[model samples]
Target: MNYSIGDFSAITGISIYTLRYYEKESLIIPARKENGRRSYAESDIAWIQFIKRLKDTGMPIREIQKYAKLRAQGVTTMADRMEMLARHRAVLKEEIGKLEEHLSNLDDKITYYRTEIRKCTNLREDRRTAEVSCCT
Candidate 1:
């Protein structure tokens, strides 16, 4: 069944403006009525969801567009698309490694702060005990 643009937006959780923008950017191409009302199909829905994933991956619009173009070219482009995905995967791996390094540093800093707190607490307790004994 064909879906109106509003229905498409509701189902996909992509705003109507975004749907229009995708169409304009050639990332999506929904059908149209004779009167020019936009209509979407199940394939369009899947494409929209895929586009969301691409955006979530921090893919640039130009790269996404290139991927879209390759996709439109059919099975012959599979190897090229796979290569593109592999490149993106490498970048993501490097980013993850950097983030993990930062996380390790944060963990070490947290441990240092905990040790300092413990030392300060012990010193404060010792000073309190001395003052009590002297006053007595």
Candidate 2:
């Protein structure tokens, strides 16, 4: 189905300005009508969703534009596209490893807090006040 630019923006969750910007950057090339109005098709929706995913993955605009250019070149650039995606995947894996390490550290801190809380409760039962090493 053909949709006007406004309709395209609404469906894609991108602002009209951003849609135009993408067009200007050659990241997206929407179909134009006789009156010089931009229109989008179902394929454009799929393309935009893929573009959004790539952007979400921290792909730079220039890289995305490069990918888009390759994509527009047809099946011959499949290898190059695969290479780019593989690079991004490696970066994502490293990021995930860092996140996991941070999460583990947080879990360790939580466990320490639980133990400290129990000790404080026990000390409070024995006396009016408990000295926490953290405060000293």
Best by lDDT: 2
Q: On residues 49-118, what C-alpha lDDT tens digit does candidate 2 reach at each position?
A: 8888998989999999999999999999999999999998999999999999999999999998899888
Candidate 1 lDDT over residue span 10-40, tens digit each:
9999999999899999998888999999989
Output the lDDT of residue 43, model 2: 95
Error of 1 at 77 (Å): 1.1
Instruction: Please list the C-alpha lDDT of all candidates, in the order they appear.
Output: 0.88, 0.90
Which sections of candidate 2 miss by over 4 Å? 128-136
Clashing pairs in 1: none
Residue 7 of model 1, lDDT score: 96
Candidate 1 segments exceeding 4 Å error: 129-136
Model 2 earns a TM-score of: 0.89
Model 1, global lDDT: 0.88
Candidate 2 residue pairs that clash: none
Instruction: Tell me the deviation in Å of residue 69 in model 2.
Output: 0.5
